[model samples]
Target: MFRDWFKKDEKNNSRDIPDGLWIKCPQCSQIIYSKDWNENYKVCIKCGYHDQLTAWERIDLLIDYGTFKEIYKNVAPVDILGFTDTKPYTQRLKEAQEATGLKDSILAGQGEVNGIPIYIMVMDFRFIGGSMGSVVGEKVVRVVERAIVDKFPVVSVIASGGARMQEGLFSLYQMAKTSAAIGRLSKAKIPYINILTHPSTAGVLASFGSLGDVIIAEPGALIGFTGPRVIEQTIKQKLPEGFQKSEFLLEHGMIDMVVERKKLKSVLYSILNHLWRKVW
Candidate 1:
């Protein structure tokens, strides 16, 4: 039994270990192999770390038939202040368009999961890290209004850093405006499903990110006003483990549920099924 264990199996340790395809797990900060990360919804194998997902990928997985009617597609931003910072804001917008093949940060549409109709708003983090500006806020309000008019539930997938700084205080106003719109939707008695994705922070969180009837967050997503490091510095103390995380927030009684990416659709379907039973 002891003889075979000590034998040289291969020259594995003789040479340098080559760099494997790596992607940062948004949860654990572990750079893991791309193939494994992708296979596990970008979750880290070592620590069950969940990574951030793009709007396109998220919508494709959550919606049935991959057939959602897009709304508010042409609501482009207007440069009222002639804003510039080495590159013009409009030019930056063009660059983002070319990079993401999306008109703007937000994607609004009507889609169904298992024939249960719902209006969705997915924010693409690729487009300026999904910052919520006036236009993004306006588009979200339009979708909320549409959901109200259609008498359907609203499901918003949020992944944003904060208010769009390029627009200055104008972007900050979206927080209040969007919150008011959600308040109106709430008054309509239509359910709002807020699926908070990774890296959600700042102004967006201050408003609708926490306003869902049943709030759900992807595991390992960062949800907070100020980041952990910033908070630690301000408080002059080291933060606790897993601060601002979905699980941490859940423990502190902030969120309703912490769901994985793969199970999101089924969970949503189940919730909706139970809700719509009394209606129809």
Candidate 2:
């Protein structure tokens, strides 16, 4: 009891100090200072915890300094059946825009990684779970087409909850559109690297998420068509521990490797470097 009292006293006294800042490390559960962590790009020094990054942050971290150029291709919305629930579809679009600060879910552009020019696309989950709708499909197809035309490789970082539910059958067509574009890229022998982020599911998984020439996943990310709970309810059986996790997918031959966040740039650089050595 005396020891517990002393510990509590120490904790209270420590809080009195002003040279303290709190940041959570996802790997080792350490509380660090903001200055220290921001200097280290939010990676935990103790256990290399990779903090969740926004899509824009990922592009910033991946690309060479001052080498990203945005490619804007405005795609009009296709409103079939006048889909609406609870509020008008336009109102939902407005809310999503205000919340995510994005005109759309996917961002595509040209960026240089270590002086090597490449095409890149990333899905912003904050925009309706990064659901692949008509605009997303158009964006992806345009990027892939541009990549093929320019003889550049495409690296797609995806975190999607599958096809957009609001668009119905129109959403499903994107799967075919993207798959066809990827096929064209393959026929041209251009490499496509799919970096699967958290919660990649359903139509997204069925398409480009799994079609990379080299597929990589973050540690412990959940990547599968159906989530564990949904499968459990449908199968009426409990899943084995850690099923459908990145490691499980690696073991099951779905992913090539599980790359840590800090090392992600290095690993991708090596692959692109090796491939470009032969081409450029």
Candidate 3:
């Protein structure tokens, strides 16, 4: 009986498990069960490295259950420039849309956080690197305008690679447009908080991403205008370790705080509560 039981255990150990049941942590290289990783908000258990989240996942993480009402769902990107690279801009948009199930890279809406009403915008890096185009800029402007009218605070979670190059000048123009809208929000004295995520860079970083009254970044997030490699090549000097990371930026006085992914909702709620109380 003992011999039979040992053989059965060996057979079970040799059985093939389906793919995606395990995840490899990029930072620590430790294999983790997918269930545990998801339960931890996709953060690495061994090293605490934060993985990128889809816009909907982020919304579910931050917004109170059943309280998120998406706006501007109909606003889709247009190939105004008739732009084409290796592939046509339209085709790329279609593929990204099909893959991510989003009209654009951004998801903007009104949601309640811990029973506090707020307007929130989240960018999904999966969609064309979360590049900002005309629709994204328009949605951002509209969301902030709505917040101004509703007298509610605004929160933006930025995960971007910068302006959409296919749109050419139209993409770059969003920087100005979004900055001006945030200016209006600032003038209104309403609280605007920005949560910078991994790969928050380029045009997005230069504009409204940096205009938040309180800017927060996730641990280990890449936050910068230009990438470190490009800067090093241009300057012909090696960059410092951890350059432009969330922790580095915080140490350099660039951002307000570096919060863990698991604590983001609570931190946001606490900050919003304090800031909202001052507004009233």
TM-score, one value per model: 0.86, 0.85, 0.95
Which pairs clash (backbone N, Cα, C closer than 3 Å) in model 1? none
lDDT of 2: 0.84
| Model 3, residue pairs in steric clash | none
User: 208-254 in candidate 3: lDDT tens per residue?
Assistant: 88999999999999999999999999999999999999999999999
Per-candidate clashes, comma-separated: 0, 0, 0
The positional error of residue 43 in candidate 2, measured at the CA in angstroms, is 4.9
Task: Give the Å error, residue 218, model 3.
Answer: 0.5
- Lowest summed lDDT over 10 consecutive residues: which window, candidate 2? 11-20
Writing each residue's lDDT as its tens digit, candidate 2 over 31-65 gives 88888987777778787655656678888879987
Model 3: what TM-score? 0.95
Kindly list the per-residue Cα lDDT of model 1 for residues 1-280, writing each as its tens digit: 7997888867754766566667776546777778877777766787876666777777787888866888878888866767898889889889998998888888888899888999889999999889988888898799888878888888989899999888988999899999999999988888888888888899998998789888899888899998999998899999889999989998998889999877899999987787667444
Give each model's whole-structure lDDT: 0.85, 0.84, 0.96
- In candidate 3, clashing pairs total 0
Rank by TM-score (best first): 3, 1, 2
Candidate 3 lDDT: 0.96
Predicted structure with the largest TM-score when compared to the true one: 3
